[model samples]
Target: MLTYEEIMLLITALASVFSVIAVYYAIIEKNLVRAVVFSAIQSTIYAFIYYMFMAPDIVLVYIPVAVGLYPAVILILISKTEKVEKQ
Candidate 1:
């Protein structure tokens, strides 16, 4: 069996990979809403990694601002403009 630290490292590594994927998709996505969703996904993965690293305080603050508030604000701004990005 893996030790606690090893397991945590593994999880953090996986989460980092997923966050990178989310960021890539967010950048390439044509729809503004979908991009926002992808950005949120990336932020959530970062929060999880933060938790894995035992940073509860940072995670607590990050969850609301990055995962919740920032996305909500971006979505509202998106709603005001065109849904799809023009080439």
Candidate 2:
């Protein structure tokens, strides 16, 4: 079995990679819906990293706020906005 530190390191690395990908996707994606999805993915990875650090309480609180509420709010805002022409 992997050591705790090793597992934490791996989770942190994965979180970093996910964050970078999310930023890149947000910049490149013209569609608001796609950007919101990418942001949600990044939030989920961050919650995983928090869990790996033995912060279950933080994960519990953050998952709903970040993964659930944030995405829902973004979707609502996006739905209200007028569609823009594709560049």
Number of residue pairs clashing in candidate 2, backbone atoms closer than 3 angstroms, sequence gap of 3 or more or interchain: 0
Scored by lDDT, the top model is 1
Give residue 31's lDDT in candidate 1 (0 to 100): 89
Candidate 1 local lDDT, 1-87, one digit each (tens): 999899889989989999999999999999889999999999999999889888999999999999999999998898888889999
* lDDT of model 2, residue 30: 82
Weakest 10 consecutive residues of candidate 1 by summed lDDT: 74-83
Model 2 Cα shift for residue 37 (angstroms): 0.2
| TM-score, prediction 2 | 0.81
lDDT (Cα atoms) of all candidates against the true structure = 0.94, 0.85
Q: Which window of ten consecutive residues has the lowest lDDT sum in model 2?
A: 77-86
User: If scored against the real structure, what TM-score would every candidate get?
Assistant: 0.94, 0.81
Question: Which residue pairs does candidate 2 place in steric collision?
Answer: none
How many residue pairs in model 1 have overlapping backbones?
A: 0
